[model samples]
Target: MSSLLGSKEATNRSFRSIADLTVLGLLTLLLAALPLGASGYVLYVVNLLMVYVVLSLGMHLAIGETGQFTLSHTAFFGIGIYTAGLVNNHWHFPFPVSILASAAVAALVGWVIGVLALRMRDIYLALATFAFGEAMQWVLLNWESVTRGANGLRFRAATLGELQLVSDLLAYPFVVAIAALMMALTFAITRSRLGLAFRAVRESDMAAVAMGINARAIKVTSFVLSAAFAGVAGGMYTLFTSFIHPESLGFETTVMVLTMVVVGGLGSVRGAVAGAIIVGLISELLRQAPSYQEIIYGVILMLFMMFLPKGLASLVNGRVALKKGCAS
Candidate 1:
């Protein structure tokens, strides 16, 4: 029985590795090929989708992995954007430095929210995070002295030594590279022992604690990881785009990313990536029709929830399971 179980585990690991490589290979190929003849608008849209991908991946870590219903992703994202943009605006350092600073600052703020999350659960935890998100947006809106208030903050082009990212075409490669890196990192984290602890705690903190998993620490770590991803994503945004508004970092943005994670399958990394791209494109396409956008988006959400609550990942899983059963 032990040998059989070990064999089964090994097979599953192989299957997972193949699936991850297939997804990453496809995504990398798709993004990599876009630069050949893609227009500026196409480049911009893809860059924005990459940012959404990172944000959704982060959301998955908290709500999907650790089962923490924190709504502070947008807040962390805003923290990253302002931090990266402001640092670039004021300093002459390389843009990578500014982006790293953004990630550090966002992670620090996320840590505070994570500590606060220890005392709460479910809706209360979500509400607290959401409230914090709102407060941060307010700061971006009213802090005219530094943030330039409601007018929006526009910074200069990002630089790396002598190279300046003055156009979307120039920035596309870096954005794609970073997004790919984040996607691979997410997959790596999910397969690690730390990820095992995250899901264990998600199942039940009591059970995780019994197994010596340090549930509290796991929860905090999930939040930190999520925030850092959002921070990096915000930095990526600064690579192609120079201006940001508080309106762009509001609760609605969080909801959109949460939708991508949920619609893709909460705990599935492939689901997160695929969901972000598919659903984000739909959202972007609908921007031209402002009046019916919300209505259409609402209908799509309802349809998915009613018919495919487990998300697109479940469909793939079902097919894989069926094949295995047939072979057996």
Candidate 2:
């Protein structure tokens, strides 16, 4: 009777934990949706927020989950956008096909980079990746035969096979859907056995290797997957913006994406999402201010690093802890 009672109690605790997490997730959804209640510039900012969320999620998968520090996710994003643009603009292929091709190409490059750099320590890996990103930018800028050199490419209307969708307002829902689906997929991965392997590797690659886990393979897989997700977001970005440029892969853009992940929280998915939204909003808001935005941006980043080092999601988790304490 005692064992049975203990089992039942354990089950109940598990259910309660799941319920709490579900409620928190629903609340996050509600928060994301709040901008929809506004219009014009607000909606535009919300769209930008979604883009950053996707970018940060990819970084979270690589850095937080797999323990790989990449300083050049933006390069993969640029590859995806440019690949999709080339396919769509030159070949006149369907949008879905173009997006997939972009992801595949980016994944291939990511795999190659991972294979080459996995043997190096973190700092060396970072420098190598950064170099590759700079090289990509130079190639995109000077490869006139393909990328049109300094003058970027302009894409025509995007299509879904026989169907064609137009208007930014109409397309907003699709972008949101893609972002949501990608985020959910990321969450699922984080909850699976692969995620466990990733965590083990992150905690200690040597230990993970001792435990019979292929650390190099895990790192490479994570990098490829992260690049693929970033590619999806990039494809969507290019289609929405209808243009592609070499500057998209430059060092500054890379720093911005890295900042989103670091500021949010290294390993937490929620932190990645929160960081992306907050940083994206601040950047867009600063753009509007123009005069004092740079000063404000630098100050905000410093404050985040100094105080809320874990990002806004940490603040949310703290409130949850406080509420549970009160309930108890």
Candidate 3:
């Protein structure tokens, strides 16, 4: 009996390993083929999807993993874009430098918000963050000298010494690479001690505190990390696009990201990425039917919540588990 159990466990692991490799191989093939045959518009949409992936991952880190409800991600994203764009426009710094600066600024602001937010919980925290997001949008719209107000700010093409990325096709590689790096980083975080602490806090702050985890510190760290992710995503935006507008970085944007995270499966790294891609594509498609977009989007979200509250990731995992059970 013992030998049989051991054999089964080994077989399960082997199957899982094979499945993981297969998925990775398919993803690599698809990404490679896309640039070769995809249209410019398709590349643009894919680049935007990459940015959404990073943004949703950040949202996942804060709300899903750390159990902190924050609605200010769009604010951090806008900050990154404007800050990095301004620096790049004036100083002509390389993409790396500007991206880092954007992340740093967003992280710093996030730290301040996190420290203050420690005083609030649940709905209060959500409301506070929402208010902050709105306030930031106002600042972006009214601050003519800095954000160029309603006129919007245009970015000169991003460059690396001699090579300038003036088009989405030229920027696609870098954008995809950055998104992949963030996804890997997020996976690493989820496997580390910090990730364990985040889960603990999410499960129950009191219980986590009893385990000697500094709940406040962990929460703050999650906020900072999430904000940095959003900032980097914003930097990625500047790489592919030429314009930044306050209207695009507002409450609706936050809601879109929140829906992606929730529909993808809250607290799941894979879910976040999947949700971003799926929803991003849907949103792009909805552009053709602007009159029915909101209604359709809302209905889809409602259906998911009603039937798959655990999100799409749960459905995939359920299928995998059923297959393993059959094998056993």
Strongest candidate by TM-score: 3
Q: How close is candidate 1 to the true structure, as a TM-score?
A: 0.94
lDDT of each residue in 1-328, candidate 1, tens digit only: 8787678768976997898789768867877788998999999999899999998999999988899988889999999999999999998678889889988999898898889865799999988998999999999999999999999999989999999999999998988888888988998999999999999999999999999888888999999999999999999999999899998787667777878887899789989988899889988988887567556666766877899988899998998788666745
Runs off by more than 4 Å, candidate 1: 1-16, 19-23, 291-295
Candidate 3 whole-model C-alpha lDDT, 0 to 1: 0.92
Query: Model 2 over residues 149-233: C-alpha lDDT tens digits?
Result: 8898777767777756454554566667777888889989999989999999999999999999999899999999989987887
lDDT of 3 by residue, 7-92 (tens): 98888779878987899789978987899999999999999999999999999999999989999999999999998999999999
Off by over 4 Å in 3: 1-10, 289-294
Top-scoring candidate (lDDT): 3
Per-candidate RMSD, Å: 1.9, 3.7, 1.7
lDDT over C-alpha atoms for residue 282 of model 2: 71
TM-score of 3: 0.95
TM-score of each: 0.94, 0.85, 0.95
Enumerate clash totals for all models, in the order shown.
Answer: 0, 0, 0
